[model samples]
Target chain A: MTDQASGSIHSFYVHTLGTPGTESLFWLCATLAVFGLGMRLQIRLGRAPWANPVLFSIILIAAALFVTETPYATYFQSVHIINFLLGPATVALAIPLADSIRLVTKSLPTMTLALLAGSVTSVVSGIALVLLFGGSHEVALSMAPKAVTTPIAIAITSQIGGSPALTAAFAILGGIIAAMIGETTLRRLGITDWRAHGLAAGIAGSGIAAAQVAQRDPVGAAFAALGIGLNGLVTAILVPVILHFLPG
Target chain B: MPEAFFTLLVFQLIGTAAQAALNLPVPGPVIGMFLLAALLIWRKSRASRREAHSPLSPDSEPGTSAASPALAALSRTLIACLGLLFVPAGVGIITELPVLSANALPIAVALFGSTILGLMVTALVMHRATTGGAAPEKLPDTGGQVL
Candidate 1:
C-alpha cells in the first residue's frame, strides 16, 4: 500500500467514528451494538447463545479499528484496566464450586470422563487442523488451549511457546462458537441430559454458557460448575504434555 | 475497596501457594478456587463449633448461609471484575500488532479450526454423558442448530 493512500485511509477512519464518540459512554454503545447485532442474528435464526460471539465482535472491532481511526494502542490503553479483571473473574468461579462441592464429589467420575474427552479432543483437533492447514507451531500452541477456559488457556499458551494474546482470542472464539453449537450437536448425536447438557456447555463454552445453564436448569449448575474447572485443569495438564510432541 | 483488596490478597497468596507448593496445573484462579472450596468444606465440617460463636450455625440458621460480610463482599467485587476481563487479551493483541499481522493466516487457522474442532468434541462429550451416565437427566432441546 502506498504511504499517501494509507495516510488518507487513516485520516478517514479517525473522522468517521468521530473522536468524541470513542470516550465516555461510546464504548458501551459500541459494545451494545456489537452484541445486539450478534444476538439479533442468533434470535433471527433461532440460534443458540454460543454461536460465535467472538466472530461478530472481531468483525466489529476490525471495523472500529478502521472507522473510528483510534489506534489499537490507544484503545488498549483505554481498556487495559478492565481487561486485567480476567484474573479475578476466573477466581470468582470458585463461588459456585464451593457452593456445590458435595454435588461435585458425587458426580466426579462422570464429570472427569466428560472433561477427559473435552480437553483431549480440543487440543488434539486444534493441533491437527493447525498443522493440516500449515499453521506455524506458534499458532498451534496459541490455539492449543482454545477449548479450555480463559485463564488456564492463557497460561497453557504461554508455557508452550504460543502467544497468549493470540490464545485469548482463540479461547474466546472457542467459547462463543462452542456455546452456539453445543446443544444442536448434542441432539444430532442423540445426547440428552440437563446435567450433561450443562456440563458439556460449561466445559466447552466456559462461564458464558454456564451462566445460561444456571438460569435454565439450576440443578445442572453443579455439573456445569465442575465441568468448567475440570476442563481447565485437564487442559492445563495435558496441553503441555502434548505440546512436547508438536513441532514447537 | 480495602475489604475487596484484602480478599484479593488472600486469594493471591493462596493461589501462589497451590501453584508453587502443589504444582497445580491450572492457573492462579483455579488454585484460588481450590483454596476457597477447601475453606468452605472446612467451615461446613466445623459448623457446630463455628455456630457456637457465629450467628448462622444450625441452631441460628438464617434462611440461607448468607456468607460472612467479608465473603459476601468478595463475591460482589469479583462480579464487578467480570466486565473488564477481556481487556488484557485486547491489550496483548495491540502490543503485538506487527506479529499478529505477519502471521494472520496461521492465527486465523488456529482460531477458527480449533473452534470447529472444540465444538465437535464438546458435543460429543455431552452425548457420552447423556447415554453412559446412569443419572436420569433431560436432553437439552434447541433443534440441533449449529450457530
Candidate 2:
C-alpha cells in the first residue's frame, strides 16, 4: 500500500508538470525567483561594477532550461507575459525624458553634436570591425545597432534584416562592457565634465551604463537620461537612413 | 495606478496604430514616447501660463504642471524595471548560440572596441564643444574625481 501511494504521488507530480497552466506557472515563478536571486547576489557582492543582475539572471535561467532539455521557444512562451510589458515600459520612458528636457536644453547644440558623432561611430565601427574580421554581412548587420537600448536595437535589427535575437544579445553585452570600462576610460581621457561623462555613458552604454552613472551623481543622472532618450531617437533615425544610402 | 497604466497602454496603442498606418521605419512605442513628451511639454507651458495670468487661481497646481503624480509614479516604476524587461530577449541568445560561437571573436572584438571608441569620441566631442576648445573644466564638488 505504501509503495502504491508513493507511485501515485509521483504520477500526480508528472501530470501537473505536463499540464499547460502549471507549466506556465512553474516557468514564470522560476524566472522571477532566479532574477530575484541575481539581484540579491549583486547586492551581496557590494554592487560590484561587473555584477549585473540581468546578465546573471540570463545565464542562470538559460542554464536551467538547457539542463532540463527545454526548448527556448517553450520557455519564451511561458514567460511572455513579462515580455509583453516591454512595449508599455518603453512608452513610459517619456516621463523622465520630459523631466530632463529643461536641464538638457541648456547645452542642446553640444549634446546634439556629441550624440551624432557617438551614434555614427557606434554603428559604423561595429559594422566595419565585423567585416574587417571576415564576419558575414548578416553578422555585420546585427552589429550595426548594438549601442542602442535593447528594445530599439531589436526593432532596428529586424528592420535591417539582421537577427533580432543576436542583436539583443550584442546590445546587452555592449551595455555590460560599457558599464565596466566607461568611468575609468573617461577619466583617463580627461573628460572631467559630468555632462560629458554622462552623455558618453548614456550613448555608448545605453541604460546600463547610465544606471551606474546615476548612482554617482544626480546631475549625471539627469544628463544620462537625456543621453538615452536623444541617442535612441538619433540612432533610430540614423541607422535606417544610412542603410538606405548604402549599396546592398 | 490602473488609470495611469491604462493611459500608458493607450499611448502605446496609438503609437502602434501610427506605425502600422504609415509603415514607418521607427517602432510604435518610440513614436508614442515622442508624442507623450510633446504633450507633457505642452501641459507644462500651459500651466506656467495659467500661473502667470492668475497667480491666485486654485487651478494652478504645482506638481501637476507636467505629468500627473500617478502617471509619474507609474513611469518611474516601469523605468526602474526596464533592465528586467530585456532579460527574456537576452535569453533568446541561447537560440543563436551556434552562430555566436562561430563568430565569437569578431563579435567580442567589435562589441568592446566599438563601445570604447564610441565612448571616447562622444566624450571628446562634448568636452570640446562645452569647454569651447579650452582645457576640460573639472567638476567643482568632485574636483576631477570620478566616483
Candidate 3:
C-alpha cells in the first residue's frame, strides 16, 4: 500500500512539472530560490568582498539551464518580470544621488577633475586593451562601460550596440576585481584620503567596490555613492561621443 | 509603495518620450534619473528658503522633509536589491559562451587591467588636487570619520 501511494505521488509530481503555464512558474520559483540561496550564502560568508550574490545566482541559474537543456530564450522569458523592474530601479537611483549632492558640491572642482579622469580612463583603457588583444569590435564596445553600476552599464552597452549580457558580466567581474585590490592598491600608491579611496572604488568597481569602502568609512561611502551617480551620468554622455569619432 | 512605484514609472515614461523626441543618445531611465533628481533638489531648496524666512518653524532636516516618505522607502528598498535586478541579463551570458571562451584571455586582461588603471588614475588625481601641488602631505588621520 505504501509503495502504491509513493508511485501515485511521483506521477503527480511529473504531471505538474509537464503543465504548460506551470513551466514558467516553476522556472520563476527556481530563479528566486537560487538567488535567495546565493544571498544567504553571501551573508553567511560575512559579506566577503568577493562573495557577490549576483555572480553566484547567475552561475547557478546558468548551470541549471544548461543542465536541463533549456535554451536561454525560454529562461529569459520566464524571468522577464524581474528584468522589467530594472528600469524603475535605475530611476530610483536618483534619490540617493540627490541626497548626496550637498556633500559632493563641497569638493566639486577636485571631484569633477578626478571624475573626468577616471571616466575617460575606464572607457578608453578597456576598449584599447580589448583591441590591442585582437578582440572584436563588439566585445570592445561592451567592454567600454564596464566600470559603472550594472543598470547604467547595461543601458550604455545596448545604446552603443554592445552585448548587454556581456557588459553585465564584465561589469560584475570588474567590480569584484576592484573590491579585492582597491584598498591595497590605494595604500601602495601612498594615497590616504578616504574620499579619494571612495572615488577610486566607485569609479572602477561601481557599487560592489563602494560597499567594501562603506564598511570601513562612511564618508568614503558617501563619496563612493556620489562617484557611482556622477560616473554613470558622465559615462553615458561620453561613450557615444567618443565612439562617434572612432573609425569603424 | 504602489503609488511610489507608479510615480517612478511615470517619470521613466516621460524620460522615454523625451529621449525619442530629442534624439538623445543616453537611455530613457537615465534621463528619468536626472529629472527626478532635479525635482527633488529644487523642492529641497524651496523648502529650505521657506524655513529660513519663517522664524517660528523649528529646524528640520530639509532632505527628509522634501522627499516624500513613500518614495524614499521605495527607492531604498529597490536600491538595496539593485544587485538582484541584473541577474537576468547576466545569466544571458550563457548564450555568449562562444565569444567569451574564444576571447577569454583578452577579456580578462582588459577588464582587470582597465579597472586597476582607472582606480589608480582617479585616486592619484584626487589626492593631488586635495593635498595641493608638489608633494603629497599626509593629512591628520580622522580615523575614517567624515570631516
- Candidate with best lDDT: 3
**Displacement of the residue A66 alpha carbon in candidate 1, Å:** 2.3
Model 2, position A9: C-alpha lDDT score: 56
Worst ten in a row by lDDT for model 2 chain A = A213-222
In terms of DockQ, which candidate is stronger, 2 or 3? 2
Candidates sorted on TM-score, descending: 2, 3, 1
What ranking emerges by DockQ with the best candidate at the front?
Answer: 2, 3, 1
TM-scores of chain B, in order: 0.61, 0.81, 0.82
* Tens digit of per-residue lDDT, candidate 3, span A151-244: 7898899988999888987887788788777877888778878879888888998866775665455457557767887898899999998888
Q: For every model in order, what is the number of clashing pairs?
A: 8, 0, 0
How high is the TM-score of chain A in each model?
0.75, 0.78, 0.71
- What lDDT is reached at residue B145 by model 1? 36
Cα lDDT tens digits, model 2, A84-127, are 88778767767766665665676788888999999999999998
- Which 10-residue span in candidate 3 chain B carries the lowest summed lDDT? B138-147
Query: Each candidate: what lDDT?
Result: 0.61, 0.78, 0.79
Each prediction's RMSD over C-alphas, in Å, is 6.0, 5.3, 5.6
Comparison by TM-score, 1 against 2, better one = 2
Candidate 3 clash pair list: none
Q: Estimate candidate 2's alpha-carbon lDDT, on a 0 to 1 scale.
A: 0.78
Which regions in candidate 3 have their CA more than 4 angstroms from the true location?
A1-15, A132-138, A148-169, A175-202, A205-248, B62-65, B127-147
